[model samples]
Structure formats: structure tokens, C-alpha cells
Target: MSKRVHIPEYEQESELMAGEELVGGPAFWFLHLCWWQEDLRALVERFGADPADVDALSDRLTDDDAPWPVFRVPFGGGHTAVVALRNFPDDSGIDYFVHHPEWGRLGHLGQMDGHDTGPGLSWKELTAIAADVPDGAEGLTDPAERFLTLLPMLGDIDTPHDAAAVVARALTQCGIPPEHAPHIAGKILDNSFWELPSWVVRDGSPVPVCGASASPRAIPLAQGITAGQARDLAEALSGERKA
Candidate 1:
């Protein structure tokens, strides 16, 4: 299922200085996968190129030393729509656009705010180019839709090693000793969201409990404890007091 998201309103007239750079807009790996899918390939082919030849595309975009515009749109389920734009060398007053599920897009030079509708061109044109790219790719209607469309790609990753450290700290908050908490990963529901196998560790094994946010205010994974999860954690806390 696609996650629902909202775009934060920002000023439309912001601009970037010359020679500024925006890197990794189009989630590099996903761009590679688009090469194998026919529908997705058609979208890129419209620009007279093969998705398999990313180097060629990259080279062309950087030939003129122009700045790239990058954006990250957040969705509710730990997913963000990313895009960047490159300048159109052949065409006058046009730009090349790219997208990644989380990383971002490579879009036209000098169009940072995504609100310019210059002479019959809107920031959404490239999104419309891949509008029918399939596999929920058509969901790139707005910043939010684009984010939800890419949310599913994050569902199959292993827990990042760094989280173990954070989870260790989180355990300490519940009065559990971090040294005894030898940890493992949780299911990859969304790579962008953070959760552990459970904060409850018993007998040198993790007792899978759910619903606690390590940092309720951080990027990639910031959430709150659910009432039920909080209750379970409270029980664990009480157990700590008893012991």
C-alpha cells in the first residue's frame, strides 16, 4: 500500500547560486532498476537514452557545469520522494528531471523551489513524463504522491548497524542494562522508520515487544510510542523495579 504524505509549504521564489551542486537526487540504485522494466524504460527513453547507460546520462548533464536542483518530500510511512534536475543542453529553456524513492531527484538547474511554470513548463513536467511508468509510478502527481509511491521500496532492508547503538541507549531509558541487551534486527516494514526486535531482553535473548520511538524528532525514523506498546514497556519497567 502507498503511504500518504504532505508537502510543507515553502516560498516559491527561492534560488541557488551559480556552481552550487546537488548530488544523488534519483536514488541511484532504483534508477538502475528502471532499465529492466519496459514501462519505466519508456519514460526515460523519451529523452532518447537508455536507463542502463546512466554514466552517459550523467556525463551529458554535467557537461555544462550547471547546478542541479534537489528535493526530498516526506510521506507518513517513513518514505520520502526525492528528485533532482539537470539542465537541458539541447533544448532551450528546458530541464532534465530524475527521481528516487528516498534519495531525491536530479532536476533542472536553477529551479529549486519547484514552483516555476515558465513559458508552458511546470516543475511537474518530468514527473508527468514518467507519469505512466507503472508500479505506482503514476502516483508522482504531487510531492506527497511521489513520496507514497516510493515508500514500498524501503520495506526489505536489514536493520542498520547504527541502530543497535541507538537501541542500546533506548534500552537504558527503560532501566535495562545495555550490556545485556545483545541485539538483533526488526522486520523491515519501512527502511526509513526505526524500531528494534523489541526492547525487552530476557535470559540473554530479546523478548520481542513493539512500539517505542528512539527519537521522536529525528530524520529518517522519528516516531512515538503507541499506547499499547507503552503499556508493554511500562510492564517491563515495573518488572525492573520488582527485580
Candidate 2:
């Protein structure tokens, strides 16, 4: 009998790669962890699948042809949709795509642009944030959500806890000495988020912006604000709060 596939141990050396090729990477291990923590039957039901098919879908996780673990969402007119993670061409991030036999690939605009479409920074800023992400830190399951969480940090416009999370993630991803990571993260967090440089671009054609209904996670629009101006604003707003 074939051995059952199981979630692998988290390693400090793993890196991002195609989900299908994630075999032993951090993202792959994290995905397994998500599955473990989540209700499989509920997930299958949410995917519009019969609960009995859970085993079959789980089995497909290891199938090469299957690539990403996916589920079929039935649409009107006899069409079935497939939602899966696919590697972006630039290798900056992973994104989900909905595929239909006739309609082709349907992807989020932010996924295509490499940013969170929901009131977030652009791909460039996201990449800069990812650079700080160490190899083995936790909490990143949905790539889009992960990227979204960091958007506020780009503008230095977040609470201390949020700021610390970003710094800690970076420290962890870089494999900083575990003992030192928390200390460094705390120190960095002590700095005001408003003081950080504007890592996000403001001059790109059709610049990304937070809509009126944007989430709290979205960074406030850059509005051509310079780093020094942002620092000044941060100070003005906080009256020497230290961060």
C-alpha cells in the first residue's frame, strides 16, 4: 500500500516556487498546515463539491498533472470552473486563476499587476516587502491576503502591532538568529510606520488606488507623498509618539 502523504516539517531554508513544484518549500508546507487547521468537509462544500469527494481532491494534491490543488465550481450553462494557484511569470508572487473550458483564464487584476486589488500597494512595493520575509515564518496561506497585510507597512501608516508583524516576517524569512529576531522586530516596530520610506510607486500608468469602499488593510493612497513629507506628517499626527 502507498504511504499516505502528510504535511512536511517546516524548514528554515524553504523558498517560494510554483505550487505544483512546491514539494518541500515553505509555501507548500504552509498550505498543508492550512488544510490541517481547516474543516475539509466544509471546504469541499464551499467549493460546491460533494463531501464524499474530499478524499479524491486530497489525493489530487500529489498528482503532477493536477499541478495545484483545485476544486470545481459549477457555473451556469454546463460550465465548470477551476480555481488554482499558478506562478506569476515574474516570479515575484503566486496568484489564483479561475479557468473555464470556454472562457479561458480569469485572474484578479491585482494578481496580474502583482498587488492586492483591495486598496493596496503595487507589485514593486510587495516585492520589497517580500524581500524582508525570512524563509520559515508563519501565517501566510493565501498569497493575496499575505500581500495585502503588508500594504500598510509600505506607507508607514499602520499600528505598532501591524508594523511588528511585517518586520518579524522579514526577520523570520531571512533566517535571522531566532533569539535576535524578536528583539530586532520589536525595535523596528518601535519606529513609527509613518517614518518608513514610500516603497510604493505613485507614477505608474493607471496607478492603483484604494476605492471608497477599501478595507482597513489597504494603505492610504500615496498622493505623491515623499518620504520626508510622510515622516513630517507622522510626527504632526503623533506629536512625538516615537512611532
lDDT of each: 0.29, 0.33
- Residues 1-243 of candidate 1 have per-residue lDDT tens digits of 223222222111222222112212222322322332334433333323345556654553345454433334322222323443334354222221222233232221122223322111111221222232233332233432332223222211233456445433433333333343223111112122223222232332222222233221111111143444333323332232112
Question: What are the TM-scores, per candidate, against the unseen true structure?
Answer: 0.22, 0.24
Q: Write the per-residue lDDT of candidate 2 for residues 193-227, one digit (tens) a residue.
A: 22333223234312233332332223433234444
Clashes of 2: 9
Off by over 4 Å in 2: 1-93, 96-109, 112-156, 159-162, 169-176, 179-209, 212-243
Which candidate number has the best TM-score?
Answer: 2
Error of 1 at 224 (Å): 12
Q: How many clashes in each structure?
A: 13, 9
